[model samples]
Target: MAPFTPFFSEGLYQNMRRVCSESEESIHYCSFPQVEGERNERIEQSVARMMTIIDLARNIRERHNKPLKSPLREMIVVHPDVNFLDDIAGKLKEYVLEELNVRSLIPCNDALKYASLRAEPEFSVLGKRLGKSMGVVAKEVKAMSQIDILEFEKAGEVTIASHCLKLSDIKVVREFKCPDGLTDKEVDAAGDGDVLVILDLRLDESLYEAGVAREVVNRIQKLRKKTGLEPTDAVEVYFESLDEDKSISQQVMNSQELYIRDAIGSPLLSSTLMPPHAVILGEESFHDISKLSFTIYLARPALVFKSDAILLLYGGNTKSVHGLETYLLSRDHSNLKSEFQLGDGKITVDAIEGFPARNVVLGEHVFLTVGDSVLRTKGL
Candidate 1:
């Protein structure tokens, strides 16, 4: 009966609806869910800041015509004072990556340093304190150069018409006009208080591959819905890209196989160069996207991979593998290198030639086998 009846709650109610069962007709008849943890305002503030940063990133994506699924190379968060974000940014870095769909989140000290800034007086706040002199104060503010505004804000006060105006009376706006005159996709947002979020809109090879992966995942999910496949039903995926350049299609399939597999509930996924001759006895689906197109063949589970061959200790996305890749370069690579704990089990993969393969694990038994070296990991 609640407005936010969760799926889990609905399932529980359905199971208990029978008279023979010791359950109620509906979750509304049951007690409210118990609170197992306490809420902290400090944590709330940190999360709020993270959300604000995400919103800022989304704005840049929208303005540049880049969809949320497409990953950007980098996003720079600029706030002279990111009090709550300081710790959260370090602790919850992965959340930022997935939410913003950016390869990296760079928290910079001065995001506005490269761009021009204009300070406009928040007339409502100014009028209340300055009375009729608000107009005069705004004019003085408009006359001030970008540097002057920065200096004024740093001082936290400005003297206009001999009246001392505190920082509360002024609002700073960051403009995307680059002083260096090099053209780039750039945008800025004024976040809570004086924080400004600036995003660098450029996609390198690595980031472009990530974006392609996202597009493939979206297309596959759409195909699954069109074919009326159940969410829990595992299916075999055969992807054929419409892209003329085979390299681009292969690169996406290579880089984002794990993501595609997890998203579509498929244990066995692959991109085929040659199209299947005819619609097999298998239930298959086909679809095309504007930028990226593919045909996905879905088949009921027949066990694509042997369980004894290779197994993931934990049932999770490949992001954990990506994290391991980053860890190898950092000083804190010791603990995770031995074993990565996920779900109910743990996985271990040794690095080869200072790098791991794009698809760390495939099928069931075939895990990473790099260059002549095969690091056998145990499945718990």
Candidate 2:
């Protein structure tokens, strides 16, 4: 029990005892698991830095009361070490964007440039190191400029009163008050001397569209939970926009159509847009997101398959009887068929009728479903 106590949980021990028939009936009898590899300090440091960046973003979000689902326009990150900042930014740029609900991330040189910084000397470190000069050093440190303080933080040492001091020697704090040139629009930021994150709350048309897309996903997830649908089950989705000044309906269809399809496991199966008043399948609901209203419809589980055909070749140089016969032999030559005259012979293409087909809808637009076996749509 003592040997396995560190690695094995009670549940894991019970499971092991039940499953491993050939081994001893107790986890205590088993050997401890071996370590697989050596630790990489650089990678660990990079990850730690990334976590700090994420924490900074989270703090800003909390201060501004911005929900994680509500996507923001941008996040400005300022760090004293350019190389370290770039390493974290380049390595985990996408992760930051996703976790922070931000569209763009801009890395700046000194985050304190936008703020008024004051230096507060650490009495303990300064007193022990400088002794008699501590009082004089504190006065000098308090008078240092933001640039000098930043340099002190970055270099881990500063010259004050002819005495040298390092990071262990000082503490830098960002006050909540905004500095000059920062309007009421900007938010208060929190960070150590090393890193800072500030979020831009303003939203443009594209950002608004992205937010709506997130809402669509959220609503679909809620519907899935309410209806008790399996994760893989595909549901036909229908929606109508309430915003009039901008084309919310069109934006949802054009920008988020593919994402909506894949996320909910339901591709838009309709050949045409469903009218606003059209009766949508399954449990329906209404949502007001970012001051935009949407009437959403989710259809029952459907495994419907769609089919299409193309004329690979039109032989006989437009004048051959065989070409005409080939065109006539093609299946389902209804209103959907296309006819092209090449030379004298004609080529025809049509979608096969009577096959199980999918017709899904998103708002006022419908995706053309034409594939075999498993259905697929255009890339997002």
Candidate 3:
């Protein structure tokens, strides 16, 4: 963005002085005309010429090579009948930068269409490289109108408020409070033109991707008739962490599992590459460990597919390993105990309770067992 320059700056003043001098010369020439009728005609002609010169000068200044110097930038010329000037300006401002990168500015409207026709092949090639088909590219251009609506919402106000219509298959799991005199039923009603505001609240991973909050807004709109007379208004949906205890990675893992189950006919745990581990207990398993030492066990044999085999398990503290000797002695897994001691390894555990596993990818046949329970296995 360029710094603002005053209208009466040196360069502008010089241009204005030139324009005034040209106008004065024209007026003087007109005054000296010989015939009375000719003088009047000369005066009229001079005024018209002066006006044209001024208009040309103004156009040059407006479209000058200099950078933008004011927050109140360019004036858009549109048909006089267009009623939504503010709405259009607001939407445009949302997407267009104050100082656009040279390559970012593309012709719109008539100019865009003309350019597209002339560069059709090149456009097609570029679109294909970007993973979009020519038809899709054209469709996107046509969809600009709908996109503008979203832009308007984002730019016009910091908080979005709108009534939403519920989809038939969707359901509301919670009641969101609103100040627009809307009831639960009203918010849940199924209808068109229902307004709901989307607050810029940080959401849990699951809710964020699933658009649960947006669904709530739609439900509210649907339930309007049942609640009472519906009011046309917008509500802000603020971000609230739904699962604040869990880390982002843990939420992502859960979401991945859910997606797999819903779309691929198998849960993430059910996949052959990484099956869930089974836990088994023996009669003497509880008594073998020292109070201060704990055994780390794996159910399946370790298979190193990659250079490293890392398993991240969360939820434990120093106290967790304190009672291990007694617990192991009770369990009578002496062989397991011997193997754990021979590994000469480190015990890694978190001090707090939260989602602990992160970036854990297992290789083939690597089965991790804890306390006779298979913690995880390669290939479900």
TM-score of each: 0.60, 0.63, 0.15
Q: Which lDDT tens digits does candidate 1 get at residues 98-164? A: 7777777777556357445778888877787877887888899888887788788779898999888
Clashes of 3: 67
Q: How many backbone clashes does every candidate have?
A: 3, 7, 67
Residue 5, model 2: Cα distance from true site in angstroms: 8.7
- 194 Cα displacement, candidate 2 (Å): 2.3
Badly placed stretches (over 4 Å) of model 1 are 1-49, 82-88, 145-148, 179-181, 186-193, 242-245, 265-290, 302-380
Which candidate leads in TM-score? 2
Instruction: State the lDDT of candidate 2 residue by residue for 1-380, as single tens digits.
Output: 88966566756877766766687666667788888899977778767877887888787777777778878887777766677678756877898888887888888775556555778888976787788888898898888887887777778897778887778777776544455666546555667655666777766777777777777788768876777877775445656665664465566557776676667656543323443323344555454676776666665332221111112122223333333333333433322122222312233323223222222211111112221112423333
Q: Candidate 3's residue-wise lDDT over 326-354, tens digit each? A: 23233423453344455442222233234
Could you tell which candidate, 2 or 3, scores higher by lDDT?
Answer: 2
In order, what is each prediction's RMSD in angstroms?
Answer: 15.5, 10.5, 28.8
Per-model lDDT: 0.58, 0.60, 0.28
Candidate topping lDDT: 2
